[model samples]
Target: MEYRKIFYNVSEKDMSFEDVIDRLKTFITADPRSEYVLSVGTDSHVHAKDTKFITAIHLHRKGKGAWGCLQNTFINRQINSIHEKISIETSLSQEVAYHFTSDYLVELSELLIPFSDEGADLTFEIHLDIGRKGVTKDLIQEMTGRVLAMGVEAKIKPDSYTAFGYANRYTR
Candidate 1:
């Protein structure tokens, strides 16, 4: 039920959410520990990749399951719901963020466990890169403020890092 939220930043040229998801899929496939989930929140720029990609991946290794939610949208409504439940908000971009709590993470983990057993450990990851400028820190701060107004824990990170961290391998 305990989950860790890690953030990172990367470049935004010739990169899309799909690229991140593909890398994650490759990572899961190579690892022996099957139970895990990978989620990628992208900007609006990389939304249309003309591919039938999976939105989430489930890694089932042994009896453990890890569920990854590839969220593309982080509107006020979603943030408020997560803040109310978990008190933790993960912002990938000014426009895309996700909130996860112990209970919800546990639920996600449970949902993904079965996939591992059936050799379906990897699920499709979501992309949210919208390819727009002006989604700056101020916007994120505003969003965070709104979440806090609702009595929820919220934070914001640079969109560049969220989109390209995998390729850059920069630690957040």
Candidate 2:
């Protein structure tokens, strides 16, 4: 199946990884003086006998406008536990962040350093859907630790819009 990656105003459906890198470069340069924060997150919903998962990559231009891409998949397994569901969601987001750093870091760093040198901090983040006020509270430490171990920062509920906001939209 084709990877249906959607941006805020466009769809990057079927685009290659290299193409995504290029488009991201264009997005960053579009706001020359804006600080940037790149994030990866995933949200899942169990429907019928399957689970729908949506993973998103976002580029936030601080106080300016932002855009990102998303990829979704459907799993046939019937996951009954909340722990399993949230753990899988965190893993998906971490996978994307891992790829962003390992597969495209050289290219992304080249594109982002100029802005960083100009006083714009170009940081990367992994968004977890767990929050302190819910059943997911217990998993925060483990999930955040996994993300931090991968060398990227992690944000949880209330602060992780990429997971609950953007990725959630397509989980249905």
Candidate 3:
């Protein structure tokens, strides 16, 4: 059931969307001078009976440190189509990014305004599971287009650690 969504990370677990926003705000203020990247991504693994999808929302304070949270979705059936699987993954990432509305961005940006001259900034990204290499190549435009259409940046492959790295780690 997608009714009550919750996100969990190492420092905290079972958090709501508002809670994630609050924690992220705290993380930013904790080191206001650092550049930040807020990313959303999803990855999936198919098992004998089901396909498990893990969506991750990550906040990075440059090279110093980072915090992330993830939520899982399951389909009680194998996802044989690469298109379908990757499509769902992209959708999940979009769902998370959609929560960070223009108002939220303004608030987040205001937090970094003071340190902007020092290179402190905020970037919002939607990480797609599709890439420029391998079978995912064909779907790059379509998937990335979906994300870009939402007025957010999209990253894939070697650059998209959120989907291919963070979320992938938990899909297992």
Candidate 4:
């Protein structure tokens, strides 16, 4: 439950789910006019006997910059298959996105109503680490489809900064 602020300045420390949700709410409530794009992504690093998974949530405020937080977990198992690794990463990201959608997003939506007429559209994106240029290329479709089935948009590879940038940075 560690919190790593990637785009904005904030003290990094372990945070509870409630703390994370409150931080996210603060970002939205502070700027009602800004359109928000929320995204989740995960990256993993496998060691000798364990795998470290880092997941991130990016709250992008349209043209204005964005702020994000990350959490990591360590699994005491060797992940040797690329497909399994990518699937796990996508799963982790999806789970976090689901939490935001099911819980925090509802609260944010109420705040967004007054701004609806002003053209504020919320976009929740699931960023995947797979792309068409690497070995993960073969997995792009399946992973993207999984996200789509969840009724959310998906971004892969070159477009998935949350996974490759923030999450990857802390996956040690």
Candidate 5:
């Protein structure tokens, strides 16, 4: 098993979550490996409106013992959040929770990368907070374009029920 982390110091004033997603897609596609797991991190600032910057980490594993590797990778990148908790929910419904110091967020974000030798199937989950409605719309548009270009099937969720119904699931 292998783990990789990547960090981006996003200029909150200029870049939105959509821009980060586009760059992430490019980074992933540029690699030759077919399987990976990605986790993205964004800080929730107390004083300012959520900036939505992210750190993405990928875990690669092969064959029968892959789950253990994935779990370890997740543990290594865990961060302690005042408002949120990082927990591992296993297939059997067992959950393990831990608290981490604030500095680990950057460390975890810097770990996102291709674990080319692990030989397992690839999966990804991105965690981000979109602060405004207009920016969210733009971000969704950009995300749609990148996902389509990659030829990967995805499911997109919006804040409300009636706004957009799973745009990634059905192509227009």
Candidate 6:
């Protein structure tokens, strides 16, 4: 079970779910004055027989530097439908986002409230690959709606770097 949840961090060794949360806590505490955004997104690449999906969880400290990790999932067969791909991507992101439940987010936010004077803040988001452009335009409503129902902020297209950039990088 632990093996399945291991997330690969480029700047450091691989980490478990617990390790990632602990690291984020340390990062936020080290400088409570910085703004933080914890975002999750997923992107995929299709192969001849299968597709490789990469979901990234990014902890960004506003103008400052940040930390992140990736989890990869592979489907046994190619997914030709745009809807299918988008749905799967959102599902993967949901899996990661759900880990940060309401209670967990409150705990994390409590850490920053004390340093609010130093501009300390946090935003949680789920970035979707589908946008209002190209072939994905039709999916904008459904996909974003799915994320919104989770009670976390939802971002798309130009604003969704976690899926468009971070996870996309490794999917290829």
The whole-model C-alpha lDDT of candidate 2 against the native structure comes to 0.79
Per-residue lDDT tens digits for candidate 6, residues 1-172, read: 2324778877766688878888888888887777889999999999998999999999999888988999989999999899999999999999889888643677777778554465778899999997888999999989889999988889998999999999999997
Shift of residue 109 alpha carbon in model 1, Å:
3.5
How far is each candidate from the true structure, as Cα RMSD in Å?
13.6, 3.3, 2.2, 3.8, 17.0, 2.1
User: Top lDDT: which candidate number?
Assistant: 3
Candidate 6 segments exceeding 4 Å error: 1-4, 113-118
Q: Write the per-residue lDDT of candidate 2 for residues 1-172, one digit (tens) a residue.
A: 2223433325546665456667788987675556778889889999988998888888888888787888776789777798889888988887667667787655655664453456555778898898999799999998899888988889998999999999998878
Q: What's the residue-level lDDT of 15 in candidate 1?
A: 31
Clash number for each model: 24, 0, 0, 0, 12, 0
lDDT of 4 at 70: 82
In the range 1-172, model 1's lDDT, one tens digit per residue, is 2223322223223334344344444544455346443433332221232211112222233355432333322233322232221222223322222333312333334443343445434332322222234434234544445445434333234333333333122211
Q: Which stretches of candidate 2 lie over 4 Å from their true place?
A: 1-10, 112-118
lDDT of 5 at 27: 46
- For candidate 5, lDDT tens digit of each residue in 25-75? 554445434454433222222223222212222232323211110111122
TM-score of each: 0.26, 0.87, 0.94, 0.86, 0.25, 0.92
Q: Quantify all predictions' global Cα lDDT against the true fold.
A: 0.33, 0.79, 0.88, 0.80, 0.29, 0.87
User: Cα lDDT for residue 42, model 5?
Assistant: 26
Angstrom error of the Cα, residue 93, model 5: value is 20
- Candidate 4 to truth, TM: 0.86
Mark the 10 consecutive residues where model 5 has the least summed lDDT.
90-99
Off by over 4 Å in 3: 1-3, 116-118
Error of 2 at 53 (Å): 0.6
lDDT of 3 by residue, 31-50 (tens): 88788899999999999999
Query: What's model 2's lDDT at 42?
Result: 89
Off by over 4 Å in 1: 1-40, 46-104, 110-135, 146-155, 158-160, 164-172
Best by TM-score: 3
Between candidates 1 and 6, the one scoring higher on lDDT is 6
Order of models, best lDDT first: 3, 6, 4, 2, 1, 5
